[model samples]
Target chain A: MKNFTQFQWLKYTVTNIPDGFDDMYWKKSGSLKISFIILIMFFFGIIAKDRLYGFQFSADYERTFNIIPYIMKSIILFVAWTVGNWSVCTLLDGEGTIKNIFIYSAYAICPYVIQIYINLIFSYILVRDEYIFMQLIEITGTVWSVILMFSAVKAVHQYTLKKTFTAIILTLIMMLIMFIILILFMLLIQQILIFISEIFTEIIYRLRA
Target chain B: MKKFLIMFLCVIIFAFPLNVNATYNYDYMRNAIPSQAGYNVKNVLYFGMNEPQDIFFSGENFYIADTGNNRILVLDYNLENIIKIYDKFIFPNGKETQLNNPEGIYVSGEKIYIADTGNSRVIISDFNSEIIMEIEKPVSEIYDQNKTFIPEKILVDKSGNIYVISGNITTGCMMFSSDGDFTGFFGANRSGRTAENIRNYFVSDKKKSRRKRNIPTGINNFDISEDFIYTCTENSEKTSDIIKKLNSAGKNIFSDRNLHFGDYQSEYSNSGYKPPKISDIDISENGNINFIDSETGHIFQYDKNCKLLFIMGNISGQSGGFEKPSAIETAGKNIYILDSGKNNITVFSETEFGEKVHNAVDLYNSGYYAETLNLWLEILKYDGNYTYAYNGLAYAFLRNGEYKNSMKYAKLAGDSELYNKAFQEYRRIFLKENSGKILIIIFVISGIILIKKRGEKF
Candidate 1:
């Protein structure tokens, strides 16, 4: 019994694990991610969009039979891209690296991937002008996006439901901060542009005269 | 085997009773459509305009502590004439009616009392809108920090007795009879998790954040119930307001202090902690106390003993839903609630079920205890399970000092966890009475044995 007790003590002594530093960093970054999204969406839309935005994917197929499918494809793509960008941005600020963004974005698009497939079947079954059915599809699509966002963040942060909620709040605050910053920056840039425009207009008039 | 059986029986009895009482029946009040008719301004008066702080209804008119406009706006039942306006207040200024942030209004006979919160004094005005008297307790003159007291709300009884909620660091509510006699004063505001600690045993822990946390939410409005005064205090962040029912002498009279959570933080983010003010509290005719969360446009209800019944509100910003309901009052069958944000009054009427219970309680309390008991019994005839009505019967009996009948009906008040403490008290008394003789016999035998042993040893 004494030898067993000593062995137990020795095992514990040998295993001195470090604190969860990455978890702490992830929380702070997750909070900062909200600010980033708000900035990109609201105030600094011009600059942040330039860095985050990419080429629009669209096609005008000339087949009347394929019109509904084509439109649905674009809508799905839009929601998928939004989910993908938001998740990648959040995780990139946390434990994710530049290369991991691609992996995280694919994971973020998981919901849209599942949703688009389900909606395709519903579209085929329903009449073309089924407004009510289409509305249900739209509402469920939005709900799926929220669930995807939550799950993607949860997967990356490795947190419990409660901690995940806290991270969401942090994200919201970050978004709010980004919004404020964007608004101020936009206002400042607008004023500077106005000043430069006036000076340029005067210079052109003088040269013409 | 015998001991195990006995223990098992005891466990079953205890556990069953506990589980049974945890569930309570919650009945929502009937939803009423907004009335466009403003004909009876005299019937339902509007008190407190511009975030009107507090209000009281007497006879036909309502006296308001119009905090924002710095004056009292009295409206008649006909909703007519925004009627007599009293601006003359003393304390801060020499203006038209020098008043500052007036809160709390109560009417007794021909006298009207106002809690001038900002000026820290109780200003009184007669029926004709004349400043009758002003009561102030000056701070220590030696320190030259002499200042009058700030009062929140006032209460008056049929005897013209006045009760004022006052004081600072050592703040407490006080009372003075109609003849200007200081009846009694009790209460001391102590430091705790925040500023509103009246009893001071609240503990705060960063680790225990999951449990329902109690902090020194600000005390906003208070009303005198039949036996106790109920005060509503908003949480530290104004997220929710807890209604604390205290005796006339200021003793907490409830097991779990009832709270009415408001969306103050969500609405008025600019004010931060200062937002989400609980503007007023009033007891309905059925002995139910209702609280108006001014920020969230919600009204909360509590039974006479301060048990929370329900919280009802529309999340929308429209007026009919009660936008910043600052003052609430009830008359006859209609409940009049004032909306400071919308500058209108929303009235709620009882549903058939509500009318039945309200009529029952009214009939019971008005010297018709037997008829009231029968009415409640009649309700049980249909539902056969009106625990609240049974509890009401228990209160009526207890008030009349009929302890036996009170205990009998109280046991029938159901086994909900909500009434566990009350039922425990009933059970305790029952056990004491049944085992009284046995207890005496055991004590006497023990005494005789001690004497015999002493004599032997000696």
Candidate 2:
């Protein structure tokens, strides 16, 4: 058990979810490296879901293709989810740290990343009439990941099911608050830069006069 | 000295305007691509007509409603000779009056239907210039009491049924029987389902009552085929129902097709985004629907299935372009557009590429898919980005049992429905051809599994 690799531990965590998370919390068996790899995979998975899907199923307009939005969305969403959950858990007397929350959350969404590639493959194989199968596969992956997410949060914070749900609701609210604060911060920086530039322009005009 | 000479040459070149006949059509992705000219300006007939509002071809002659001249000019089939001009007519009361701004004219058989708009009456005259029948404003209860009847366009069917479109009427084209009896309205445009209407649906009854009722835009013009009346509207706010083909029952048959009739993307102007204002519609001899946009002065020609074949003309001070294209009429292989601003009839003769596209479209619509194969292939050689040609080639290949080629063209055409049909056939053929090999593999795997089980039992 001590000599088990990170890959083996990841497999164990996926197979025996509740027991695996329990061990991660008590014995500290989970690796942050594995979580980082999962996060990177999630980023590519989001892109592949848009760009690599079959033509019939793809709704993206190729002429207006931009990769920056996809990159920003994935990074911002993942960071916000991790930080929001950590902040909520800290205020609720939960046991999980920010690092633990990030690792567990990334592990929870591993099924989603794997299923995106599977869905991309199925899109090419199935015709439009057989779209129901693709929809079912996508819904199953999302539902399974959601269940895994709930379990991971419960185990990581060592909270009851009700407390875990409340914490999740508060985390979502915290994310929205953080987004508003980010907008305000950006506007404040813009105003300050404009003011400084105007002062420089005024100084140059005075010297010229 | 050399630079001065070069500059002088540049000024001379700039002084003379280039005759650039730039014709374009939208591809499968709705991107405008410069295409081969489908039509060329054969001639511009200037007969001293002022602001002709409408033009109609009756297979023998061309009738122009010279609105500003207050007369109708009948030109020969070649459009070079003026056959006759009718400006005065004796009324039923023995009163002689000249036409007051005849805005619309339609020639059916030996009869000439004129929408004398300023007089608020439709005059049905014959080839002899005799007033056969005069249809004034109807005095029926269904006709609105407060509204004024200002006939803007008029057409007569084979059964002598007169369809009149009033400029102020939004209900539809006013239909009248042979004896000038008012029938019910025909082909009224459906009210636009806008965001405000949706909100009103959920709002309180008091608030809803306070809001003004939404009315549909009036039909600008219409043309008749065998049993259908093709109408076009000039509603800039709504794009849906811009063009409608109504049967006898006044129901739009194209309601289910979800087709966009004009330019999918709106053009930006100083005011705002300007949507296509489809002012006139005319069906050609071979069932091709031609629409002339008054705003852009562009003529959009589509096949019977609404597949765009060619887009010609523009708002330019050139031979092929028009300043204000009010009417479009097709005779034989040439298209005649009445430009009220230019005060001339710009005739567009079909080019070699246009003839090929029309032949292929006609064959495809007539269910001769196999024959259209060569024509469509040739057309693709001329214009590779033509999506309609790709669609025709896909159907031709499907009829010829070339399922793989059919799928390829269908995908290129961006027709997923056609692609699915071809893919289904290809999949069936693939499975049938490999059934024996698949069966052998399955049997070998099961046999090995059974042998392993027996060995373990022993």
Candidate 3:
């Protein structure tokens, strides 16, 4: 495991699953660089899924296209998931740190991220009648990634299956709470900026008068 | 001095803007795109009419139901002179009664059908103002007994079947026989399955009173063409079946087609979002559907396939614009819309672009796809962003066995079904033409693979 390169580790993580996560957890063999690259690929994969999919399957409204929402969806969700899982596991007396949770989470979704490109390519070749094959590919990839996610949590935290499930549910709740707080904070900042601008405008108007 | 002269000229040019016609059509993305005027306002007739509710053209005359004046005015086809007026009718009992705010009129041959809305009855009369028959509230067990019958619009089929659109009849058009016998409702609107309706379905009768009952909106207007009756509902709350083409069996054939009849997007105004309210519908001579939206005061014209052809007119204080477009009728090449608020008729004549589109659509609908190729191409020259033209060209190419061009136009039109069809044909033809070359390549690859295997064994 120590001798393996970042690509080799990713291959092992995809194939061996729990064993690879166990090595990363106990021996610190996981590469943060590979995890970061995977996250970037996942972001681009989401965009490609939306814009580059076949016209029949894609529901993108080209006239009202905007990139900000996609960026926010990918980056914010990734950050929140990492932080929420780390905090929840720590509270539950689990052993995983923030870095381990981030790496494992990224690695766990490798199958789904890779499946996006495959689905995009197949969408152009397959007609409407042959869409069941595409649907099967999508379902298999999603299910495999979900199973890998469960194993990753179990191995990173060194916990039983039941404890791992509780940690995951708590992590989802934590993510929701963080999202709400983040929205409220953004709204508060907006109000403060508006108030400051209004005051500055009033001062300028008075001086001109 | 030269610079000053140029500046003055620029200012003068900027001050007087070009007289651009306010005509637009929705693009493939449902965004409004400015296009050439399909129909130009030829004239606006104001013959002292007041609140004309409906208009119909038959033979060489225009029948206008002037509701405010409580009379029917018949004008010539040119709309230049009054042909006749039916204000009073002699009843069978030797009694003469004036029309009480008649809202609708249908002239079939020499017979005149008037929906006397204020009198709560439909009066069938001859051209000489002699009352032939009167149809009152339908007496049926299915019809609600407590509701009052107020006939708003009426039409007579070729077989003498009378269909009346009443104010309170939510079931559908009130069907009447030639002898004034109430048969049954026709083409009733489907009640929406809203959340409240779903909840009420599961709740007990006693507890269901807490929620409001969802009643389907009644049909506002209808026109008969051949054996089909096209109906329009003015209610904005329910837009799924705003315009329906009902067969003789009273079933909407356009239901499963997923056609959005009116504007796809709502416009925000001072009163919030306002969806299109289609007040009237008329089928043209070429079988094109022409419907008027009262909210935006625009007339939307669509081909037989429910593809939008052109959008004309709007809300303005001009001769062409409408205040309240209550009725629409197409005669020959002219479309006449009656505006109730303005109390006049605005006649619109088709332009060159419109003629080309109509010809292409007519030919395509008649299965003469190859003939429409030149017309559709000409229409594209007029408006390059016309998706219907692209679709028409795709079909034309497909019929002409030009699969590659069909695929190109179908992709431009965003018609994936047609694109797939063209692609399938292209692939089959390619494989057939290259069969010999393909076989030779396959043999060569197989021989190479076998040679490599033998060498590895050795």
Candidate 4:
């Protein structure tokens, strides 16, 4: 029973973190691939709470949840992080695979998700003056998530602190490039579809004549 | 011979050029067009007046502060003839005194208050011309002895507390007790957040106190509205509050966050030549806070809520125009604007449309929003450009529980606060009807995720 617990239950305990977690996360064998999307959804959903939490958003009525945009934003951010980080990590000779990077990055979003759910409940219960408490919670959650991301990258890639920070900065620049490219690609596809339709219409016009 | 003199005087009075009043209503575009419900000039009360600074109407009589003439001229309501001239003021010490540039006059009950500007005194007298109280420069130790107490305007509250405003004194309106004791200055102007002031953050207190702060945003004019005192400043910089509705503590409770004094855009005209200069403010009987901008000669009328309802007059120097507007006082439905430079008073009477708009605004301001809705709708038909009517419609709709319609009107008027409120109510209605279903879906999704997670682990 102890041996099974050591190998199985040990996957999520805090004792095997920083070094042990990153070593396992760098390999495909340690992949909890499904949790990645779930955590991404949570990461975006937690941020939506910022738009919802205080008088920043309109407060005429009780807030209504809109999940579609939050989900889409999370997915986009996840893709941006994975692609950006992988490219930079490859150049820096970091050991982590793209799959490991994705899983670790998503796992870092865990603190924000838990904080968001707690806040979603508290927002209804708390009055306007008590909003300082809500602000403190939000800031703490964000800071925790950010710190986790920094550590996650360092651990997964087995890189030094200086190398990790350098990679992170480069990742941000890469993210912007990838995002622009994606937009251009979508526009190109749209233009091609429009051209094809115009050609088809021309053919149909000749046939009708 | 006596009969001939009487007839001659009658002829001269009749020959006096009394302008028939012309009124202009602001179209949606805020252009003052010739509209009905306007006063003809009626009569320009120029009798025995020279360089007049202020005018007050009380007890069916016009009290003209004939500053240059150094006397308070009592004229009949029609400005046809003079009642009495209050030039000589008898001191309690049996000494004869006279006004130099008496700029302000207030007749409250049996007591008459005169701001004797040249003499630096406020003479409180009865209708019988018997001097009761004389408020001289406050000899209070706190009083800035260097600054002369040249009272330009005066107000006596119900409790007999005297409020006096002097030029170049930023300490605030000097407040005197009923017994003529200097209580203190009330409602001091706030130091504006200018670049010069921000730079003063690094400055030591001794240095800042030594330097003359840029004119200190002094009060240009003020008026009483119910229990509150409303003041307007003509600060060229748009940093500090140009207007304030202050309470008994001298705190502006009705001030919006960073309260602006007058029309947000074009304080003068579309050309934007002049800033908002409230030469005078008069409260209508219905609590409407109305004031005239001396710069543009424009009378900006606002409801008690500080929402502007109408703007009239101009500095075009034509008919229904003014060279320099000095003071504004409303008697009955007529608004008398004293133009100091032109040396004449222009009277603005309400048109039919103006009366209707006033009625709607009066109703809404006094909290009868539901009743004023139809009146506002009628106003829109005549002047679709009127922003007040749209605001009225938005408020009326919000009050009547028509949240969606209210939101639409607010959006049209570009009123974000009202729109947010209506949207909130609409959201509440939606949530009330579907919160249970929403909860079920959320729970179901979470349950599925939990099951999927357990399945993966096992």
Best by TM-score: 2
Per-residue lDDT of candidate 3, residues B1-458 (tens digit)? 99999999999996564532367787767767777778988888898999999999996899999999999999997999998888999988888989898999998867899999999999999988889998888778977879998999999898999999999889899999999999989998988676766676689988776657677888999999988999999787777789999999998999998789777663333353468899999998888999999998889999888889998888888777889989999999889999999999999999999888888888899999999999999999999989899999999999999999998998888787888877778778988999999999999999999999999999
Off by over 4 Å in 1: A1-209, B1-48, B78-81, B88-97, B118-120, B140-149, B157-162, B165-170, B174-185, B189-218, B236-241, B255-278, B294-296, B305-311, B361-458
Q: What range of 10 consecutive residues in model 3 chain B has the weakest lDDT sum?
A: B265-274
Ranking by lDDT: 3, 2, 4, 1
| Model 1 / residue B438 / CA error / Å | 28
Clashing pairs in 3: none
For model 3, the local distance difference test gives: 0.87
- What's the lDDT for all of these models? 0.54, 0.87, 0.87, 0.75
On lDDT, the candidate that comes out on top is 3
Tell me which of candidates 2 and 4 scores higher on TM-score.
2
Q: Looking at model 2 chain A, which ten-residue stretch has the lowest summed lDDT?
A: A55-64
Q: What fraction of the real A-B contacts shows up in model 1?
A: 0.00
> Candidate 2: how many backbone clashes?
0
User: What TM-scores result for chain A when each predicted structure is judged separately against the true chain A?
Assistant: 0.44, 0.91, 0.93, 0.79
Question: Which prediction has the highest DockQ against the true structure?
Answer: 2
How well does candidate 2 match the true structure in TM-score terms? Answer: 0.89
Regarding TM-score, does 1 or 3 come out ahead? 3
Better of 2 and 3 by DockQ: 2
By TM-score, the candidates rank as 2, 3, 4, 1
Standalone chain B TM-score for every prediction: 0.56, 0.91, 0.92, 0.81
Could you tell me which 10 consecutive residues in candidate 2 chain B have the lowest summed lDDT? B265-274
